[model samples]
Target: MTPANSDGCSPDFPDEALAAELDELRQLLDGTDKPACAEEGEGLVIMRLCSGLTLQEWEGLGARRDLRDWMALPITANPFPYLTRIQQTLKELVFLSEHDPLTKLHNRGAFERILSAELIRSSRSGQPLALVLLDLDNFKTVNDTYGHPCGDRVLETMGALLAAEKRTYDYAARVGGEEFALILPGVGMVRAEGIVERLIESARTLRVVCDGVDTPLCVTLSAGIACTKGKVAIGWEKLYAMADEALYAAKAAGKDRVRCAPIADLTGTPEKTLVRADEKRFLFTGTTKG
Candidate 1:
């Protein structure tokens, strides 16, 4: 008795056995949504599932052989749904790895990697790169007086502002607790200072309201900026350190201000230039691009 469905094409088997075989085939195809390729070799049909799936992933699923053998069965099923699930999972994992869970900004690790890559690109292209470090003013007071939730809201607000205000190519990240970093590719000191000045002005206008607060909480941000030409000998680490020093200077001079490191230090010799919040002009007494 040849086992066959209404098409009458297989070994003579009962309907129950045919149904079970079809179920097994369906289960195998369910593993991935990619269009599986069927190849015939030595009287056996091998089905390969998932185009982008690596050998390691097949091993992890422990269903490589099962899928191959199941696809050999005389049954047809679509695997697109399974592939969609796998792709969605991969996207979520990658996002969680590279982004901060709190602020939804790039995490410190991602920012460091981006900065290093940008440094290499800048070196090759001979374009200037600028780094800006920002610290929240009296952030501790927000946490102490309002609570951690309120503090979180404030951070979220700052993160939103950065995302909205930064240029399309700018890389902004929440690099540390109450601290953020921005990488400006192809931007020099004067232009970088202008951007930071606008950021300072924007920070003043940010107001976050939380539960149990008498009034909306407005926080201030102090920034330290450092810029170097693309061909400069300085690396990302040195650039970040200089920006951090400038940020410290800003805090010392007065919170809610923007400070800039000396252009000479970045160019050749180390120098310091403090830009006050009330400064009318971004005076650069140092070297200019030729």
Candidate 2:
């Protein structure tokens, strides 16, 4: 994908520089290549996991929490066992409907619906969110090298990797035959790339064992990242295009690395949307330039 510039020059993305800066911050924050969850760090996580939930989904989560408390009751302690059992059955049915049978991640239909909801939520909250499009590199080769059964196993492993890596607020989905996506609410581009980079590190070491063989094989992935330009909400289609373009860049540049959408020029720009009241005062009261 060609990187877009403010002046319509070369396709060099504006936010390209932020990657290194965030990497440095990542180093300082964790002192390692690993990604940390919100509870593990002060910053660097999404705003909230339930930001984009519909009324029904929200109530479902509430019911889930309530059930967890009730689940702890002794077998003989619960007078009405039917109630918890019914809820559990409903939750299971919902899960089966919304999630892919293989990867156990959100299926394409569910993902698109959630994407729209998330964009709206991000817009209302006035915080940036990221959408990442990822494809397994040379996956056909892996399938050919092993077998279709092995290919399915690889897909399953990737699904697990995605689910394991993302925070509770983030969303993971299998959107295509081999294409997957991650929706990160309230996370900007810089932090988004950092998260995906750590995912890359983890995938680099993955070795899935196939049937009838002791030797395990590895897989590499290419990811493209796009963040909301600012508080202004763009359609999910546009956002996906930006991420798809970046994904093209990753594939063109070489597989197994992450690329990002063009960043809006944050330099010398007034902080209207994402700044605190005190920070806005600080911006207005900055040292006068000569």
Candidate 3:
């Protein structure tokens, strides 16, 4: 399947590449090799040939032969060039539908879908799932001061950082301008906080070399974390809202820090706790450069 670019579209296929694939398929189908017994969808039709076979012999065995018998034939070959290409094209389309072209991460729509599906699985398995929302600190200042191109460079750097940090099962996505989301299945609050701490350190160390700049540009990230264990009967929407609240708290306290939403706020209880956690709970690891 062709992977989608940031714009959410499959890359244009080159004429030369298509032609080369066609040529290779033609070579495989050339009459030198015996064609394997071919069956179309649902066994509704089959294609096979046995040279000089009597009508009676053909009728007795029917038109189809076992795959083992076809494999035993010295001249037998697989012939389905069109089918192979179609399958590949379909796969490419699926990839384009789900992936973001720019950062090569799952797009928002795909992320939401996966979040719902994962929540269902978590509910069934009684496993914890956590979500982290990240926003770049001073992103607008970078854009206004250095220009949008430089800002884009910083965002691209962030995308790479998030991609590298993602585990095999994690779902990471670019959900908005200068904002990213990470879905951590089978992970609880403490481990998720540790992950965010490492990310904060990485953000502090990240540098982008903008055009015509003697010094590299550095930016920090502010994030909020929310987990399934936060509240009973909470779904993705509540979790996300709680994460967003925590994110605002991070921004209010200071940029370049991580905050986690507690159960009271997530559940929308009358006694919602607005008190921010201590600095240690902010999950800051290194000095954040303004």
Candidate 4:
């Protein structure tokens, strides 16, 4: 009598007998060099043979004697080529989504995502974070005087400058046509301000050569610097607006300067007051109260 089959074994066989049969099959496959072939109706199954089976012995094990004639058929079931193309397309899409085409900097969308994540980490770890909004002074003049090409060059130069000055952990990107934003994680306002000052000086000293002559082009930048001192729900837009206002003040006073206003100072309502002194009437629009 045949032994009973074990769990999950074929129902036709008893356990000990099925185990012995499986062992015999395994030995037969292992002792053969060529794979065992089996044909069931229209499908062909190939089992990898191990060591010593010849073509004749393999053919003898086939379910149908005529299966040997179908052994030369090629396999056509792998989808790896199509999957590879899909993977490549996905990679290109990811790159385009995350990068700015103009300056090759991280795009605003990417910047916002990264900034949010960084802010959370900084808040949890009690680390300082600095944010700077930078605008090119009189950028319109550059475009008007030369051409759009010159304007593009200036932008590329500015992007390169930021890239050079940025630390490994810092995030610098072009957030607008004439505006750039920088995120300095773990940096305080004081240090951030110093970095901005250095950048301004660098921009002022940068010279562009055109038409075989060194064109004396001076670029001035107005920067607004802020830092996260404690846990707060302050949005990046608010910080950017504050910096922009400070930048406008710098331009109004004179171009080529860095103006930084504290978050507390930015909360007050701006008042419009006119001062008449001698023959001159000056309209001052600012949050400062005298």
Candidate 5:
């Protein structure tokens, strides 16, 4: 007594019901009747009906994306197609707003937003946050001698290196031309020192060569770090100012070196390690291992 078709897998409607459906379909195709517009999920069903006269044909291409892609084309006029594309475009726009187009890293605004959030989280949890600012040493000379194109390659290499090497929770951003920032949440001074040292060492060896050039170009980094001392503290502005001060200190000492914001002002009393491309320097505790 259950409704079933000859296939026995689908409910079979009475002849009258089938005839009524066929009449409605015929009227729709003839443009004598029009169905109300609907959303994408339902729109897919309607599209299948429009594309195929037979159930077998609809089943073949029903789930494929060619239909949606075809619908978004310039020649298509239906409004339903715009629904899917609108969603996709909005996501792309959000990403572009936060990311730098050249290096494909988070831009300065995005970095500040992330840093502000992390400071709140660090203050609440009493975990340390390390902020590092790195500037390319002798960057003007590199650009003047090698040209801007080669300089661009150097920045790209640094961005890519930071993206690949930083911890998963850390955030990397291209804050300015030849300038980059790293935000490490839940990381303290000593650990921050090791992390920054490793990053600079890795960057030191990257070979950026211009076309028709045999020698690899040298573009080194001078870094400064400021950390919240395993305590509840730091407004975003204060944190950035401290890091900037540390960065300039590194520049004044010599190029291609790492410097930390004075611990007396911040937090933690651990021996600080400084990484210089040439000597492998350390401060406070003073040990030269390299």
Candidate 6:
């Protein structure tokens, strides 16, 4: 005889067939213990078993309970207890990939990405952009004299100062052991030079305290500032090379000073006054802007 369906025990089935089906179901349940029913919130259900199978497999084993009807149960209240930890781990990984571990600033890769985006924006808007390259003068001497610990302290201190001194829209990245690069958007060569001068002054006055004594360690920085205006094929490489040349000039002249190449050198010079408005007042011999 055909076996009777066990679904809700239909009344159409004969008594003998129903008894045989019931016996088969009992044997199946005995071999594989029935899973415990648990409610997983307002509109969900979870089946828990004392076996090796997972929740999905156990739920597929013939559970037909409406999840919304079991909302009052608390057995499956929290499904993912480690969600916060997982999120934190992901955030840490992202930060480690994009930021420098020692200075907590943008790494060289991150800096390049930002610079590229800014370059596109500046090129489209016709706004000028400035690139400044700075290197610590005689930093190795400091390391040899005061020790590596002190050198680390100096680098950290300088990095913090540079970060704090930058404008909100500016980007500064530590590119090497004693080198840094700053990208200034919407700034021209003249303004960039002024900024570099201020940076040099600030570095000169920065004091590093070591060994519980007020050790007045004076560190000098040489910087080259280059500004670009029109559409240029060379792009960042052009600016970088110009700044590198200017930096070489600064080092050759004397360390601890700011050097800037005229925009005319990078792009064709405009017929405007080279001197600033304020500078014109103090100058004894120079053409003034009309």
Per-residue alpha-carbon lDDT of model 6 for 181-249, expressed as tens digits? Answer: 899998888888889899989999998876643666877899988877744423566677788788888
Q: Which stretches of candidate 1 lie over 4 Å from their true place?
A: 1-77, 264-290
**Model 3 residue pairs with clashes:** 1-92, 2-92, 5-101, 6-101, 6-102
Give model 5 RMSD, 1 decimal: 16.2
Per-residue lDDT for 96-147 in model 3, tens only?
Answer: 7898877778889998888888877876666788999999998899899989
Per-candidate clashes come to: 12, 3, 5, 9, 0, 0
Candidate 2 — which residues are off by over 4 angstroms? 1-86, 264-290
TM-score, structure 4 vs. true: 0.59
lDDT digits (tens) for residues 10-103 of candidate 5:
3333334433554565567668434455333344232211211223232223223222222222123454445555466567679989999878
Question: What order do you get sorting by lDDT, best first?
Answer: 1, 2, 5, 3, 6, 4
Ranked by TM-score, the better of candidates 5 and 6 is 5
lDDT of 4 by residue, 149-218 (tens): 7788878888888899899989988888888889888887788889989999998888754332357566
Give the residue spans of candidate 6 off by over 4 A: 1-81, 212-214, 264-290
The whole-model lDDT of each prediction reads 0.76, 0.75, 0.71, 0.66, 0.72, 0.68
What TM-score would every model get versus the actual structure? 0.66, 0.62, 0.63, 0.59, 0.64, 0.62
- List the candidate 4 regions with Cα displacement exceeding 4 Å: 1-89, 210-216, 263-290
lDDT of 2 at 14: 29
TM-score result, candidate 2: 0.62
Which candidate leads in TM-score? 1
Candidate 5 regions with alpha-carbon error over 4 angstroms: 1-82, 264-290
Error of 2 at 112 (Å): 0.9
Clashing pairs in 5: none
